[model samples]
Target: MSGQDTSEVGHGHGHGHGHGHSRSRTVAGLLSRVGHAIRPHSHDTADKTDQALEASSKGMRVLAVSFAALMATALVQSVIVAVSGSIALLGDTLHNFADALTALPLAIAFSLGRRAATRRFTYGYGRAEDLAGIVIVLLIAASAALAGYEAVVRLMHPQDVEALGWVAAAGVIGFLGNEAVARYRIKVGREIGSAALVADGLHARTDGFTSLAVLLGAGGAALGFPIADPIVGLAITAAICFVLRDAAREIYHRLMDAVDPRLVEQAESILSGVPGVKGVGSVRLRWIGHALRAEVDIQVSDRLSLVEAHAVAVAAEHRLIHDLPRLTAATVHADPDGSDGIDHHAVLATHR
Candidate 1:
């Protein structure tokens, strides 16, 4: 038999089996089972778990607050570095500016990502946040490159820096500010599962460490090792580059529709455990921002009627959605047992 002929026979047999199994569970029974399965967990709070909007709003608020704090520190740090003529402190100030730029996109993304699902876009705009994260990573990479170049130039021709005491004190203040912002954003991001916020938080925390390095470099320069200032700048640039590379990889996976393997296994286990399903044929999953879309094919008895087959498909879909909270949509295709016939070929041809 030709490849197409074999596929036709297989599809026909699967459809026949699906029809036979559909009658096992009525729509009402399936819905009741789904309800029971989907009941809220004991740890869920009435106020917090009820609304996506509330959760998204809180996430945006946290990010906005963190951005404001970073901006304030950046302005102070910039002024201090300019006065002290400290190359290390100036490099840290530029890092803060890049962070501030990233924050604007994050704020815009959070505000728009919460739009309700529409007819054309059933999943809304949640993925916009993920896109914003990608932008942040790119900006960090650019900043690192720029900083590295400047550090190399400074190293080639070292210059004396003044006002060492004031510059060090400003560095200390910047570090404290960045630390507080980073911790707050991280806490809120985890609570709301906001990737953009988490990325921003991590960026801020790194800035804090870089600020401390600048303070030390400024002190070293004052103590006669003038090259320490540019050397510290080079170190900070390397660290930022590492962070950018990691974030880019994560963003790439999400954008390319790579599903979490664990999630796929969990879904397969749930379907296989359903009472009447004899075998599973194929499963596919993809990510849509924070949510997942799943599709599955299953086999059932060939003697069942069309109505019976539909019921089985419904039951399977309900079970999948009920057990998997992250799944926003699912499609189930039913097949029949060993009744390979030419009619199945026609069905496949029509869809193709």
Candidate 2:
């Protein structure tokens, strides 16, 4: 199957064998069971597909709270910048405001992502998150450019930065605010498996460091070295630019459907472990927004009937969804054992 089909695979076969299975109920075992049930777990061949936006909902909550915090931070810093006339503080404040605004697009994307799939768009609106990711990368780039421009201008045209103490205090405020937001965003992003949100959290962390740079600028100005202020501002700009490279790379990978090799390996391992699966073949995994979707190829006995082969496929798929975190769906394609790696025509002819 061409892997573009993001739809989950399902089967309705009822096997008629039942028996009591023995298992240990150790503390670890009980905890494992509890964890498995608690997480947004998917058992392969799920009767109903998981709501793809469940994580997006969580993402929305995080973004909302962060947006408010950043807004307040920017407001306070803006007041300080106006009173102190510190160019460095001004740049940092502007960046904070810009960063705060980015949450809006991501929130919109998450909301759009919750909508049901349409006939024209078979994959639903999950790609909106990736699109929002692009917007976020661009915003980071723009913030860096603006900050850099301001720093270079100030360097060429030196200005007396007044109220060093207030500037320094505002810098601390920025750092505290950004660090708080960073911790929150990173925690929620990891829980929801969102690379975009994680990248944003990293951006916030960079902002916190830049805020510290503002304190350095203020100290330098107070030490009879006005040039240190612009230099520190430039340093802040450089930091933002450096992190922008990472954010852009992350977004590029997502747009290209690049996934971690470890996830692919894990899926293959689980598929091979499933009963009746003779061998694991190709395993492809990708992120549709924060959720993972997999396409697995398994080799099973050719001697089995079509119904039995399908059962094996369903079982393998169920195990994959259950074992893999953030796995929303899996499409398991069952091929006859030993048919893999052989000429396609040979297998086709035998079947014919």
RMSD of each: 7.7, 7.3
Q: Using TM-score as the measure, which candidate wins?
A: 2
Best by lDDT: 2
Q: Per-residue lDDT for 277 in model 1?
A: 72
lDDT of each: 0.70, 0.77
- Which tens-of-lDDT digit does each residue in 19-64 have in candidate 2? 1334443334334533542332243223223434456778899999
- CA deviation > 4 Å runs, candidate 2: 1-52, 338-352
Show the colliding residue pairs in model 2.
44-318
Per-prediction TM-score = 0.78, 0.85
Report how far residue 130 has shifted in candidate 2, in Å: 0.7
How well does candidate 1 score on lDDT at residue 140?
87
